[model samples]
Target chain A: MANTETALKDVMSSIDGAIGVALVDYNSGMALGTLGGSAELDLNVAAAGNTDVVRAKVRAIELLNLKEAIEDILISLNTQYHLIRPLTGRSGKGLFLYLALDRSRANLAMARHQLKRIEAELEV
Target chain B: MKRTLRQFTGRRPPVLIDPELLAGPGLLDELSGLRARVPHLTGSLVATTDGLVVAHDTRGLEPSGVAALTAAALGVGARLAEATGQGEFRELLTRGELGYTATYAAGSFVVLTLLAGPDANIGRLHLEARRAGRRIAELSDAVLARQDRD
Candidate 1:
């Protein structure tokens, strides 16, 4: 099992063009761990704010009657790609990994694949 | 379209239905009916914003604690929506390894929470839950209105 801090560190370096990364608790809107955000990006605020994104989507899934599990939620912008991956295993419940990547340099498919691997290895 | 608490009142409304009224067979029947109509619904309950359990049909879980957590989640959900310009908070759903928990705003004072397996039909759950929520609101509102008169 990968430690929370170590796993987050791995995510920052392993994912290309990673501007910032945070492990957020949707339950209380708190960031359990964070790495690599610039002054323009407030990692904690980003983490906390995304809790609603995770929540809104989950509710939407229920409302829409979709039985599928959330693989990742992607929000694309002019310069950035915000990727949210909700951890699924028993230990990972109520938490998700938030990754901010530069759209120009990052590959979306690869980033998602890496996030899934990190989620599987992550202990909590 | 989602309904905000603002539609009911300019301010937060107090719990109108008494605890005794919550435990009434009428509400219990409504909850049971919702569970029956919706596939994969393992349990259901109604709780106040502060986490007080008004009525429940939960199995193998502590109704009181779940009610309180639902209130907490609702608070965060509502604030998050407003802050992000996502509009009013209507419902919240969280998936776990074992199952899913979905909470809906029943009315001004109480929220309806439902539990379901991963395979449960998400569409049906919402449809049935919302219908039950309307009845719950009417029943609770009427009781509170009567109390105000007395």
Candidate 2:
């Protein structure tokens, strides 16, 4: 299986305008691997922070009794786009790829497309 | 080992209920009514913060388990919002392969959760669900308050 580092690297480079990326575990609120974060934007903190978002969504789904798998979660902001792609592969369950992109520099549609592709390729 | 034991023996918060209110099926009926109003809604439920099912209209689903999971998620959501200075926890929505699941904080100790088909109008779902959740919260609180007074 490809390692978390390589998967994270691929995410940061392949997505245009990527400011930071992390492979996060929603259950524990930890980042398994991270890349491209700035001093002001810590990927570790972001990873931990987004864990809540993922867990919350999952819980809601369970409560609602919807029989489906989550594709991805998109949070748009004034200056950025935060994309959370939950890894659904056999080995990647409970893990997610968090990508932060500059709104002005990134193409939202392309970013989603690329992230989906990357998620498919991600081994762990 | 200690942690595991603690988990097993953890003190669960008591469920706030008004026997008089729940003796009938009013809450469940209300939830069913909400489902009818939202064309795409597949199911709906009201659960305690500790994940105990109070009322539900979901089909083929285990209400107690879902409520517990919702409580876990709510803990994380509330902390996440507070830590990030995003304000109080209000709602959560997850879009899935087959459809959407949405949850709203109904009141201090309850949550309202809904399921919708893929074709459901998101804006409309949010609008209707929010209104229904608020009403449910008020009804629940009133029931509890009156019981306490008596």
Candidate 3:
């Protein structure tokens, strides 16, 4: 069980062209932990705004009566890839891991694979 | 005693009462059962698709807010699903600074939301939530039917 800080550090080092990482709770729009964000990119605000995105999607599913589960959410910007992975551990409900990668320097497949590995090793 | 009897039998009760045929037991138990099966399920709640609370195992978090949020997420998820021509909207994942929120469709009557830490297992969470969602849907359908009758 790697601690939160260690887990964040490991993710930062492992992912190429990583810009920032955050752990957010969509329910309250709160950021539990964050790393690698620049002045231009405020992870806190991004987390909150993303909360709305998550909420909207959930609501839409109910209205449509579609029964399924979400694997992940990818937000593609002109220069960045915003990846959202919802944690599924007993100690980490209502929480998510958000990663931002520079489009030029990152491989989407490898990044996703690495994030999944990091998620498995992260101790709440 | 007379007042109590009148309240119980007269004008109908305020709460929905389901018959034996429709009423299913062990809702909280079922939620707990999911927890046991999915060790990473930090928390789980059953709420109506319309945002009504059914049962929850939230530590100190507000169940009402959860229901509302879940309903909202389902809405957008459905749109994305349709826009992409996906068969149905089943689950939604939201990443944040602190953690992640995953909402799964537990049938038409309910949804299950899971909160997990940064390092929690994503694959396992998806699998467990899906299984739990199915069970919750069955249970919620039964409960909703009863509520309708009442």
Candidate 1 Cα outliers beyond 4 Å, as residue runs: A1-124, B1-17
| lDDT measured at residue B40 in model 3 versus the true structure, 0 to 100 | 41
Model 2 spans with C-alpha error above 4 angstroms: A1-124, B1-24
Local distance difference test, each candidate: 0.81, 0.76, 0.72
RMSD of each: 12.3, 12.5, 17.8
Instruction: Give model 3's DockQ, 2 decimals.
Output: 0.03
Candidate 2 lDDT, tens digit per residue, A59-120?
89999999977899999998999999999899898889999999999999999999888888
lDDT of 2: 0.76
- Tell me, by lDDT, which candidate is best: 1
Clashes of 2: 2
lDDT of 3 by residue, A1-124 (tens): 7777887898899999899998888766667899999999888777766766776777788999999655678999999999998887777777788999999999999999999888877768
**Two-chain DockQ for each candidate model:** 0.02, 0.02, 0.03
Q: What is the TM-score of each candidate against the true structure?
A: 0.51, 0.48, 0.45
Candidate 3 has what TM-score? 0.45
